[model samples]
Target: MFPRTLLLLLSLILFKTTHAQLHLDYYRNSCPDVESIVRSAVQEKFQQTFVTAPATLRLFFHDCLVRGCDASVLLASRNNRAEKDNPENLSLAGDGFDTVIKAKAAVDNVQECRNKVSCADILVMATRDVIALTGGPSYAVELGRLDGRVSTKASVRHQIPHPDFKLEKLEAMFATHGLTLVDLIALSGAHTIGFSHCSRFSKRLYNFKSKTRIDPTLNPAYARELRGMCPEEVDSRIAISMDQTTPQTFDNVYYKNLERGRGLFTSDQTLFTHKRSRDIVRLFAFNSTAFEIAFVDAITKLGRIGVKTGNQGEIRGDCTIVN
Candidate 1:
């Protein structure tokens, strides 16, 4: 039972964002092919750590947005050579300080590799990392991506899919990229780690029974872990996304949640209820290795979507600043 006082806090967060200082741009220029190979090597070395694609993506985007992806973020704020090469942003947001600076660092890494690789891969991967770092599924996507010369904040708002979407809406979005419903479900496997704002799932927490909020059907032990992270009455505004149960690592917990009827979002839980979606959910739950591989495949598939095959695009000499 929530005290009700907490529910009142919801009203405070309803104001629209004043507009973020950050926005993404797209380009048509292709980075030299070497960028893919080099970035992949960098990603592979850090695979075991909690960072990797997401962190690198962050560095890629931030750098491009600031100084054309020259790896400038790697440089130290104090202007020291030793600090410039620092890779700690992977572990710490903004190196555990200011995350915006880390966003800049992400841009830096991407630019440094931009001359060698495509910005598209860098941007797609960056979104994946944001999903991963927040505790969603981390799939392996393909590299050798090209750069975009004209990305913008408005594009992201219009282009990126939102949590509020229903099945028909999602299917259409994926279909735009030649994705199927199953792929949508599988792609959603990223929900394993990333979380949402309290507003995103407030209906589940406040409207549903507390027991429902703490579904007894879930992994009893894992449920405890969840409860600790999400107290019944705490700020639903900052509620962690369903993927947080084990955000650092990739695994079958997401599917398992489906089996237990604990899928956090309406979109997530829907997979288990529909006859068509159930099998994929079950398959994912029972096989961790298969899930990881499939997840990667799905991500790779998503990477190729919505691009101009012939001349729909143009490459910018710079990823962040543009020409």
Candidate 2:
């Protein structure tokens, strides 16, 4: 009887682990036009500023990586103790938060959908829409996430990958979230459209290893260009495109840039320099279709991280505050 009971328990656990309560049509009945509503809002924002694509994408990643995809990062605390207040998250663009807030407002404008959808789900749909708008794949997003009530600055520590992280550090961090090396490579492609503050990667161009002066991995010409754009005494807040080749397009050129030593971040170029991940980078660089497919699969899996369902969390009437 003990063995039988243990076996049954194990099977139940496995079932729960594999069957997360999220689906492409989760909001079909509660809010039939939820996806379109969020998509239209995102499109309007994207039209206003190209920053919408990368900022929203990065916000989704940061939110999911820290406390799952609960939208805790969206919460604002008057005492300035929320996750968004963390120094690591301070760089998150206001446009990202605005994108979700605007979409939430749009959803609530319709009587049937008012306060019916979770901010977490709105973020997921908005992320997909922005990606599609920026020439990335537009896959169906799995919904049904709920907004987390907790958003402490303490939770953001070491949760996000640093710009200078190497392949090993990156793999270990991603592994904790159930992401594979291929997933890491595929997701890094989001950098293809974003801009990074000079402080994030200036070390690569100015004081790599405190000895080489410049990171030897960077292409010489590219390094020179970066120096010109960000002089030694320039403001750290100066922005540089992550993918100089096609800053406005979300595509596999990020991998191609890695191959050419033009990657703006150490974490990015490491994907090509590290032997274990180099092959995957080469594959993505040469095959745009493979990159897109892997990205879609990876992001879908990412959306499943630490999700709340079945009364685990609440749907907030205001995305920036708990209901």
Q: Considering every candidate listed, which one attains the maximal TM-score?
A: 2
Give Cα distance to truth, residue 161, candidate 1, Å: 3.7
RMSD (CA, angstroms), candidate 2: 7.0
lDDT tens digits by residue: candidate 2, 1-323? 23432343344335433225888788789899988889999999999999999999999999999999999999999999999999999999999999999999999999999989999999999999999999999887888888998999999999999999999999999999988787888899999998999999998988777576999999999999999999989999998999988999999999999999999999999998998888778888887877887788788889999999767789999988987
The TM-score measured for candidate 2 stands at: 0.93
Candidate 2, residue 33: CA error in Å?
1.0
Question: lDDT, candidate 2, residue 256?
Answer: 92
Residue 167 in model 2: lDDT:
97
Per-candidate Cα lDDT values, in order, are 0.48, 0.90
Q: How many residue pairs clash in each candidate?
A: 58, 0
The true-versus-predicted C-alpha distance at residue 248 of model 1, in Å, is 1.2
Query: Using Cα atoms with residue i matched to residue i, what is each candidate's TM-score against the true structure?
Result: 0.56, 0.93
